[model samples]
Target chain A: MFDINKRPEVIQLSHGGGGKEMNKLIKSLFFSAFNNPILNNDEDAARLHLNGDIAFTTDSFTVSPLFFAGGDIGKLAIAGTVNDLAMMGAKPEYLSCSFIIEEGFEVGKLKKVVDSMVNEMDKSGAKIVCGDTKVVPKGCADGLLINTSGIGRIQFDGVSVTNIKLGDVIIVSRDIGRHGAAILMERESLALETTLTSDCATLWPTVKHLIEAKLEIHAMRDATRGGVSAVLNEWAMGSNVGITVKESAIPVCDEVKGMCELYGFEPFDLANEGTFLIALPEDEAIKALDIMHEFGCEATAAIIGRVSEDRPGKVILKTPWGSRRYLDLPQGELLPRIC
Target chain B: MFDINKRPEVIQLSHGGGGKEMNKLIKSLFFSAFNNPILNNDEDAARLHLNGDIAFTTDSFTVSPLFFAGGDIGKLAIAGTVNDLAMMGAKPEYLSCSFIIEEGFEVGKLKKVVDSMVNEMDKSGAKIVCGDTKVVPKGCADGLLINTSGIGRIQFDGVSVTNIKLGDVIIVSRDIGRHGAAILMERESLALETTLTSDCATLWPTVKHLIEAKLEIHAMRDATRGGVSAVLNEWAMGSNVGITVKESAIPVCDEVKGMCELYGFEPFDLANEGTFLIALPEDEAIKALDIMHEFGCEATAAIIGRVSEDRPGKVILKTPWGSRRYLDLPQGELLPRIC
Candidate 1:
């Protein structure tokens, strides 16, 4: 039923049936893109050979517009899961990809999304070992939503929010808020001449490098939804320590700043994808920053803050003008589906 | 921001913002239902200590009319993933649940779904250790979709589709096609004064019994979408063998048979949730049937077929009247969102 030349331009309900058409579509598209012996086995579940401690995580990507400046939903799906593993100081291994596709969605578009997923997966060296596809009736769903659950081998121990200690330095991996700004711009149909794009990329490559270097990492987290403000606040509260962030060192590109100004949003309240925060000893901060620079994060990665014992469970942001304010955790909704 | 006295009747975008409101929703709802020390740790990813061969699988449930007969989407989501692990001869252990919910959805309904999930998970003893929740703007999604990814420890080996050898006995654990019929009746608003419900129950309890008994399980599969026909065809093709099913031996209740007849559907092509098929050696067929009987499948469980060497890669059905015909795989879409 899924003849290469005679396939439906738009997906039909039958394509999701656990029958011949579904088999053909899976074998021709998903299987080919995520080709692997474990996946090719075609069993009810994928058999995995795992040892030691493992990290388990799950996320569902329902980003609106599907296609964004630097990546599509598919790309976001893979990077998002892989990044979680990276933040846990784990080497991302097997991933399960599931998609809930809306009826009438174009097969061509689906192919493009799957391709983006494959390309993004290559950056993290993780393979999608098993997947499930379900098609909903028209008007029952909007476009497609992807869910990716990851299993990774823990490469190092003691990387946790609770591990942040006094004198531990906090580093912002790169410029923040691009993912949020890019999505807002695309939604508003801004035709600016500037080449702005979402900072969405797989972070495992850099995390792997840092792990191999053994720089004594305490905690790491991507500045995703609710941005750095949320991550900093949680660390301070969870670790029972205070954080002092030098406002000037927190990178915010001109594009993001402009969007924030135009939209009455704070840069700290924006979301990010590729950017991350690292917490380690003060002496190792320099080493971590150097490694980040070597990974092409130069001029962006900076020692932004430090952990303090004073005023536990608080985050203070010192402004460039010599003033300070409590960087409270984000409240209410800034933007939905900005991931 | 989350005042216990001022909770909104419906979910707001702030609930998924990764901030105070999101934290409150997670703590008040999800955390309380799937309460466990590992989940309460609140790390970016759940740290799990896993060893030996494991089974990893993922599924996204987008069943239309989130509440169905006998089970809601939440129960289905948990049972579906746990069943996949059970089929793989694995012990259901940990799961990561992610929700893509539409904005303005009822908070009360969400609680109901979550409660149903907890109840169903109790049957499998799998703990949900981590989860992600995303709220999409109204109209961007339909109701809610759940993605559950699971990791389980494999207990036995040699359980595969390709392992179905000649002289294997095929057995159906229970009456088939109830799930598909229930969904269809609901969609069509048929007031058939009959007690027809979706066969959506946690199958791990029954599967666990079989595994513990150590009866050779060549291959086992739950008859979900595309029904038993799909499973049979896949087994035939994958094992490079022939299967002959006796039409009279497959169990079907009176109500289900009536609904299928009215809808002009073949019961074998309809979906099921809790029902499953097992392929074992002919010598162990009686033992397997007895185990199923002890597990409360006595009236429904039946040895419906046998694997054969003739007509490799195909399935034949012997009718009650002694006629025989090829039981081809279900083709095209039988019913969208059957599961």
Candidate 2:
């Protein structure tokens, strides 16, 4: 392990000056954790000989309370980008990470963040090939903001929001609103002795299984920020089809349910990081669920909704009490920086 | 133009919440500025068909005094990442932009920044394909920070920092330290009444000419952050070769020279965003200079250095008045956020 012995306990502006200090930090921490031939080449940019169709995405993670129940900013940074590629039927490959760290942030804390990122990358088999770091003066930034951009090679095609068919069934990978609930719990210090960890995880493994199962997935998106409400509404508008979902079929844990009720917020409007919804033909929905179940994220794999031709460009939700209402896109901020 | 009249002048948290307001802001501002087919797909990730050797680079711009004399953070963010690919002899192609803006920032100012980005991308003919936006509460971030990750195709090879050959002539593309000096002037509100603009620019046009000219280009790098001094030191150490340069041959305009004198700084150690250095065979140096002059960025291109076999892993500088010394990498903080 490399020690921050000679250096001050806090980062200085020189460390981001593209000089000897910055070089040392990169080699010792970044290169050490993400050790690979392509990254160690020391060129101005990473040289990748990619072929065929590729998927590219970028995300900036600014989750407050950097450390949370089940993950940290670093873990979310890696998973958020990997999931974006997976949803496009792409095999996650290379990622570029850039950090804007506030001056006076503890070196020990930075090490922990890097370690968390390395551990998360292992789960998805993605390598951080290139990175940049900049340090700002005290009070300039809250703590740190991480940006991750990823590249992946497409393994299959025909997955898009506009590809939804009228008879397609929507299958959710796992329980919803756990990530948002967990963040709220941490922010309020709600230590109710509940193991309510955030559902912040890498979704490529589960997504790969569905792909291998040969299910003709029409659309897939993680219910992030605006939660399932946003995804369902966007799909309806883009595909010009109506969506009907059952409130009872949507999975929500007791802890999350309690939090939602206490805060007077709808579960569908809360954000999720790990949970994803897939739209496929009704005949293939069972096979997708079976593959998702075997992957063992949880028993929450379920078919909760289906596409309809009745009302185009709208999502209707049927409650257990036999009442129906429009599932509108969340209008304003539900939870900021929940990713 | 999409008006901010229907919206609040100050950005709110709702604009980054992945909801209706966020969607409206994206389509109205970002989508309009970076309009392209791939970006209009409205998918989780952009699909691209690429082949052969590709260069990938990432950079986060947090330049203080967002607007400087010659450029703003938006322009710097685009040029900085594009130059990284050009240094590897790649043709700039696709870029992913992610923005982290603080709440309460003026929407008008944000539009100006996005407009600047569009102008900079025009120079390199690169398209913005995918993006993510997040907003932090007021005081959580200092205005806004942008992270741009780019992918380009390498047209030529052997442009590694470790590929410098013995007896190669080192050419400075233009006068150095203008970028760092310009930023300092902006930060301090220096009313020097001088036209000292930053050297920040896209280098693909100049690099394309070099590749077309078919010079035996061994190495090329933009002198950013630690400026030319840092680049030379790294090359000497990485290639295990000695480099000797004449102090008087390095071009420094009167404005930059005056700033260096007033601040007790070394021009070689200051940053240069657009200026670059080339290492090629001595016989091909003049041809490279002629091509650079015709490009018309400036006529300050000159051969200020040479690679030698003596004193491996070191850079030696000879002064005009008959003094010599080792030009080591800049140690302490020279300037922060000068890119």
Candidate 3:
């Protein structure tokens, strides 16, 4: 007997209040989408059965525009935290999501975002077992912000930045900077004919495939925020080893490259939500790429660099002209609220 | 070689850009305050050892006027989620906090908040194992919002809203409405000579003591938004039993009473961050109150109501003059962002 016409079209402060309205909103909207035994229990907290070593990670998605070409904030929120656990060789399992939404936000938009989250969760078989929702007065916040914290049982062990050794091959999962480019395009309201989209996707499927294949992954990290440059620089300093990358070998889509040229930015320093880097023995690179290609969202995985013993604690970029230079970590603000 | 004077006085967008500056801020501020081995690992996720049945909860704190009497948002963020687990008779163990800070906020204020979080965590022996920080442009958000998600091992079983039965005595932890009144005072810049402060504090100690005392607690919940009125209504509906409250037996401070009188608010409908309500067999009320009095933040615990089978799914309020009325769940917005 639930009527769509009876529901409020836009969110209100009362929806965040811990009373009848809040309960009705939760039961009708949130419960129907994220319905599960644990969440259905009208308790203050969700009870879970967890054993052995678990991986825990958290991320807050404040991506502007709320929605982009390939994804929205909800999809990015789920994928971002799930990728963190997957990078640690963990089986993405239980997740906790909290939303700080602005009052007067369209209810239809909220439902769309939640539906996107449910769709993304299916990729990794993760469940949103616990969540919190708070509605801020309009003008106090932009629109909506999501914080997703995940807990997963570690399925594979010994994956660490310090584990990267000399002769390790570095692999990039796909072409870089699509997520950043997509956001930039949406923000600038570009009307290009290209079918460019944000590369926001769940990486657990590919990670699970690699784990099942028993590839020895030394280090794995998604190139987010500061992008590939930041990840490489951290890896170099963390392992006290030098990394040499061929600039020409690094994958970059034409749309991202074009956007970078237009904005005077570097593709390697641009963020990517779905792209990840892996370091393993040189001999295992082919097998890992094959497994990733079969299960990854995109089939553009490539070997972009390698770990070296020379010039420790630095990342060397070798240009197509055979000139070598140090690649430093990204400095200053590139794009704020780019997720 | 970390120089305090060398750091930026205010948080810049660069500090959350996931680059060198972001690394420095995290290592210098967050790491120094929440130092732990698991966090120092610097992996994408923190590896943890967990066993048995655990409780998981999430909460987002967006209380206006970040600093209030008796507590701040940082303290409330930790205590709020910890209380949820504690309410379920769980031992608060691991927490993951995410921050969405506005650009140009003072770094000094941020540090003070982080320090407050550390102090609050000490009360419950909970550690923040993983976290994420995001910075939005100025005007995109109001100062700061924190999301804290917690995991705790359940030490006591079968404490739930559905567990309340007939003859169960309901107990109020302490004087209510302080948190709401304090926030209202701060927001309104009230200069009353009353020493009214929020009742925000970690409830894990009291919950732990009760668990150790082996009290067969049926249902426990912190009276947050909508206060004791919300908890009683939900319990009545959830357990299919009627709740009868002696309005005169409830404890309310003079300051809160005055504020409610001025604002035309009901004390039962105001929020309390630290105050809690418990339902158990009448025979165990004395022992439970004794244990709570010894370890709880306040000693004003009182038996305010009882469970009955007369009017299922409803709450009855008995006035001092032998008048009775139905106390329904709060409607409309009592107060937004009270947490």
Candidate 4:
């Protein structure tokens, strides 16, 4: 077993190259984060059987400088698309990648990023079957931009925003804001960091486990760019229901909490790449938590709040200080390109 | 019916915006370029019932200066992905688009590009069922980058690269290098003018029509980034066969020929965004050309070459001057971001 803790916290262009360091990075981080049967095949493309309706999603990543703290653009590209499909309760099967590379960008660096993407796709149990590569003159583009589009089959029937109820319990998969905090800390070169890792990961297995465990999940969302507060606010507006989240029950990693305290940032507004907010019936909340925990996620699953009928299209947070504070969607990007 | 030639030669961003100009662009350009049942619906997505195996392909476009002289990035994005699926003899059904926009980009421009995509998808009989959007700070990216992924079904049984045979004739869908020449002329601001337009349009409908007409196509390839000469070289190497082509028989628009002469460039080395090369038995060559002609791509269709067993992994061109020359694959990009 490799020691993930001893690995480098910051990603470099070499991580995307198909070299020794690239292989190491994949085995230690991506393979460990998303271990599964189909993922272990390590083929150029994955073949699977679709038992039901199919859902597809695509996303592009153009994070500056290619790499960042906690995760690189490659990891974000995979996680973003996979999370989108997972939000729809789909079992991701195949992925197509296209790269627009700037001329003069280091080839070694590109190889690392591609290798990381391959490993991430493998671990996520998706195949990178078809791809196209185009090179533009230097300065015409950033160092690199990756576009990933994926196809996944719906794992269960009758899962959608329409199924959400007014009184359903809201469960958070794990701690919020770790990814945002880590990226900020790294960007500012702040001291006092104690192993603050980004929560960038593939969430399909956890979602699949929850489905198989027979939990009546009403709706699911990955609290990514907009964080928990923004996601909750959107859910309230979309479902036309009021939500009350207990601030104390929302999980926060110690490193993230310390960073937020030092930076005077609100944990609720911070982004999380891997964490998910699942709304389920009150009776099945506990089972959902157990199922997610068994998948080796951060597993600090908690019933952070519940849906309500009183104030439609509103999100209220029960603060630690016993004050009811309204949570609104972010007006602008707080940590641009953190994912 | 509108007179396509009388319409504007260069597409403005307005044509892609969802207004009158956009409607006119669609009716004149896209509807004229490709006409099919699936495309005629003009819905957000095209639905298909797969009777057999499926093949998927995708590509992204990030050309600088969104609008080009011959074709804009919008049309290129749609045509590129559609042609990829067509090369595999698949009937394209669905597409997912994701756009990354730089802040401060004109809203009118963005809408225009999107409208163009919708129109092109309609023309090609593909549906844009799902998509995503992200906004980045100004200067972080070019004006916009459009990524499109398409899914198509393999309607035929046992058609693949293995089907190629010696003595098969090579059929080009249209004239070569119009897109590459136009991009270069625009980028260099060459004073020379021509009636040549970019051959940037979807090809799946024509491929489908040819297949339905019972033309025995053995292998197909989109002569894109590296042009006809480069792609033919690759096919020769991949199939372990030799190719002999008559340079005089290879079609070239008069304007393109004049521009190449002025610029000291070879038309064979120039790129084409929308043309395809198909290999079939000599007996079926005329039938395939006839089917393509019925679809309005007849002007440039010609029997330029044939697969031969005299030499392996080589392409020989019989020049119009009665001199034999080796048509080597281009070493570098002739026109970057032509698509």
lDDT, model 3, position B143: 96
Model 4, position B198, has a per-residue lDDT of 81
TM-scores vs. true structure, each candidate: 0.97, 0.97, 0.97, 0.85
Q: Count the backbone clashes (under 3 Å) in each candidate.
A: 1, 0, 0, 11
> Would candidate 3 be rated incorrect, acceptable, medium or high by CAPRI criteria?
high
Instruction: Score chain B of candidate 3 by TM-score.
Output: 0.97
Model 4 CA lDDT for position A82: 81
Task: Assess each prediction's global lDDT (C-alpha) against the native.
Answer: 0.91, 0.91, 0.92, 0.71
Query: At residue A312, what lDDT does model 1 achieve?
Result: 99
lDDT digits (tens) for residues B137-158 of candidate 2? 8898989989999999999988
| Per-residue lDDT over B268-335 for candidate 3, one digit per residue giving the tens place of the 0 to 100 score | 99999999999999999999899888886567899999999989999999999999999988889878
Best by DockQ: 3
Task: Residues B265-315, candidate 4: write the lDDT tens digits.
Answer: 788877787788888899999888888888857577888999989677888
Q: How well is candidate 3 docked (DockQ)?
A: 0.86
Looking at model 1 chain A, which ten-residue stretch has the lowest summed lDDT? A1-10
Each candidate's fnat, listed in order, reads: 0.93, 0.89, 0.92, 0.23
> How do these models rank on DockQ, best leading?
3, 2, 1, 4
C-alpha root-mean-square deviation, each candidate: 3.0, 2.7, 2.9, 8.4
Candidate 4, A14-86: lDDT as tens digits: 3432223434644564444445544443321222334346767777776654666667778878877888778
- What interface RMSD does every candidate have? 0.9, 0.9, 0.8, 8.0
Q: Show model 4 residue runs off by greater than 4 Å.
A: A1-51, A261-264, B1-51, B157-159
